[model samples]
Target chain A: MAELLRTHPLEAWAAALAELPDEVRITPEPFVAMVDVRVPAAASEGLAVRGTPLPTAPNTWTPTADGRMVWLGPDEWLLTSTGTVPHLLEEELRDQLRPVGGTAVDVSAQRIGLRISGTRAREVLAKGCSIDLHPRAFPAGRSAQTTLGQAGVVLLSLGEEGFAVLVRSSFAGYLASWLLDAGLEYVPLG
Target chain B: MQLIACPWCGPREEVEFTYGGQAHVPYPDDPAALSDEQWAHYVFFRDNTKGRFAERWNHSAGCRRWFNAVRDTTSYRFQRVYRVDDPKPVTP
Candidate 1:
């Protein structure tokens, strides 16, 4: 059996972090596994394991005991969770959806996570992206994939004006730099 | 500063989407069986209507899904946005 190695992309950022200004804070959340699930709309099965169906609706995610099931399309979804066996989700979901001709693919290494929070969190995000970001419009459990800076990212609401933004590993550095610049005005000087 | 609605993600900024050319054009059943004139019509022609035109828009930055939308070309206002899987809306 081959053992896959996990890497830390935010190592330098974590090392330099000392204190965040009162207005906003950016935290790198590492080690979450992501899986993409797809089923043809005309398939016999509706993407389910046991009785729990993968979310069919758009822009919504359903929390399951295993992970969060995020709807990606009419017949597609992404399962995300934090654990060691994130790869197992691909196998497990494949077994469950296979009989119905659905597909499951592991995309854990393709993405990286960042958490942004504080009083100016929404304001900071609004600087480079446009997703409303208002609490009433996008409450918790709401997730969306949008462009941030020049990279494609998935934004999930963690409620209370906090968000978890997932960007591709290759673009992570650029986005982090972009975000720091966007937040410069909000961070108070010493 | 136009807002485009994605059937699933709701209304988002126009920048979040990529415009796909005219929608609802059916693919020729037998492309090899068509004349040059018919082939040209299939490939190069589009309505480009000033009033209402049905076309495709991708929530490229949002849901990453392709959907069909009907909008007024002059005003750039979407009258309806529907899922790709849904039947195309009847044009008025």
Candidate 2:
């Protein structure tokens, strides 16, 4: 059998990110294990991980030992973690949800993660995003599934002027290019 | 641009939502018993009210949930928004 290798969706954009100025930073997140979960409201307690319960409120996320659990809908959530194998995470999630009549599906490849942070991060996103990026509107831990540069993405607000974007693998390159282009104004002239 | 209030995700931009046509169109209880004309009416015909109208909308780019709203088509102002299962509010 030929050697199997995994590749990042934004591997080609490394140089573009490296060229960004200090005021504007955009970097592809490390490989993350993501799982889509659906559970009944009554049995949501079974979905806890490392003492962190699933966030039941709308458009919110809770930090866990590894990553975080983001509420996607009334009964749906997206569990993300770092440094864990995709299959292993899915298997464990499935086993944990089986008895609760819930479901866990591996969606690690469905999206590629990117972190955009800097003083101008919100401004870079404001170019294409329709949502209000003001600190008062989208504070830390708030997550929204919306469009960015015509590509669908799960956007998470991380602290001041930092954001985590999870976009479909097919649209990853497009979003990266859009981000870089939008951040051009912030890049210092050489 | 309009701001639509999603039942779960609060208010978001209109660009994030997709029109789902007239609301309160329940599925026929007995589809096999309907005449051709009746079936066509059920599937195609809809009220084009000039005033307040109840319509379905899908938050495609947000929560991805379908919800119903009452809006004045002429003014393009949303009166109220409610869940799919909730009863429609009286628009006076």
Candidate 3:
């Protein structure tokens, strides 16, 4: 008898997805997640450790060695990390950039990262999202926040045939189930 | 599938923007002193021109910044995009 790890709705989906048919494979990419932190306006200086200030907006972006951190709004930014969540880096951000009158909320547990890669990646994604994921429209390195099957999602174009989707943890199971059903049309790589 | 050049987010599809009505409407400094007609003008008056018009649009889905643009309403061609603080000069 193996000890079971406590799981949330999304975590359960991730586990169940692993047992998917051999043809339909679900690969869970490691580390990348969305951290929602609220910074107060008074202590808002030095948020962007690098990169130039946005021309018309009050935000900026700092490209990391492997990925980039994009300012989503006032006191909010999406830090793209590789492999594992940078706990020390996040702590540094909280200590260094705590808003004067705002608090930072760690919403990392509320989101899930799903990487859909393979020749049929685009075909699988198009079944849910309406955005033109064509290379001409959404080239590699580009990202957009849009609705996937009417579900809020952050879609990142990782490569010619690779994509990363960030969906709310609550909707992860539904999304994963939808993907598995739609992926049946393609030659599953799992 | 119209392409809109967001002053902050660069060129994106018009679907990413939310039309924010006319631009350059100054708020009344003294609302109590103004007449009813003046108040109505400030609240409802707008220049809905058909030719080249300066309008306000917020990149709601992108950078979420509001900027001004001179676009031809007839042809849907964007001639110039400028920051909100920049003066909207008359174009020939």
Candidate 4:
């Protein structure tokens, strides 16, 4: 049987990283097991992942033993973990939430992660993003589903000018191009 | 771009939202009992109020939840935003 290998979507864009200044960095994250969770708002209080409660507040995230749970909507969340197997997490979540009229779906392949951090990290992101990136307005621990250029992305603040941009796999190239082009202004001619 | 307040995600750019037309258009209790004209009206008619129009807006790109909003069609200012099940509030 032919071997099946999981590949990173931005593997081809690794060379583009050279154009960005050292102060601004964008690195593609390794494959993460992501599960889309849907539970009743009232019942969510009883749901826990490795003893870590899901974040009930909008646009917030709570850390788990392996990863974190990000709030997507009033009754929706994205559970991302790098340490666990995707199907196992999905099954575990499904069994736990089934009693509460909820569902869990394995969406690990739906999107890819990119970590952008450094002094000018916010500046590069601001070029194509419209949301106020000020620390007071969008402090660390906050996340927002907004647009970067024309691509829809989930921006997670990682403190001290660091952020995680999660975009659909299909739009990864466009976003990488946009970020690189935006970062070029910081690169010196020499 | 305008800022549309999502009831769940708070205010986000207007580009993240898609217009959902008039709000409070409930489905008929008895669809089979309705006359042809009433059925057509239910499917096609919507109030084009000039001021303080109550409408539905979907935060398509943001939280992806649908909410209701009351805005002045003339001034293009959103008076208030409420949840889908919440009762509409009086707007100026």
Give the candidate number with the greatest TM-score.
4
Give the alpha carbon lDDT tens digit for every residue of B55-79 in model 4.
9999999898989999999989988
Q: Which pairs clash in the backbone of model 1?
A: A145-B62, A146-B61
lDDT of 2 by residue, A1-190 (tens): 1121678888999898889997788889876788998889777854575367888888988778888799999889999877567788788888888888888898988988898998889889999988898889989999999899999999999987599999999999999899989998888777
Ten-residue segment with the worst summed lDDT in candidate 4 chain A?
A: A1-10
Local accuracy by lDDT, each model: 0.79, 0.87, 0.66, 0.87
- Name the runs in model 3 displaced over 4 angstroms: A1-68, A73-76, A80-94, A98-105, A126-141, A147-149, A159-161, A169-178, A187-190
Provide interface RMSD per model, one decimal.
1.5, 0.9, 4.5, 0.8
Cα lDDT of model 4 by residue, A27-58, tens digit: 98878889999999998875675578888889
lDDT per residue as tens, model 3, A94-115: 6745534434444556667787
Q: Pairing residues by index, what is the TM-score of model 3?
A: 0.65
The two-chain DockQ for each candidate, comma-separated, is 0.70, 0.85, 0.21, 0.89
Quote model 3's TM-score for chain B. 0.92
DockQ of 3: 0.21
Evaluation by TM-score, superior candidate among 1 and 3? 1
Location of the lowest summed lDDT over 10 successive residues in candidate 2 chain B: B2-11
Which candidate's DockQ is highest?
Answer: 4
TM of each candidate vs. truth: 0.87, 0.94, 0.65, 0.96
Every prediction: chain A TM-score: 0.87, 0.92, 0.67, 0.94
Q: Tell me the spans in candidate 4 whose CA falls farther than 4 Å from its real position.
A: A1-4
Mind giving the per-residue lDDT tens digits that candidate 3 earns over B30-66? 9999999999999999998999999999877665778
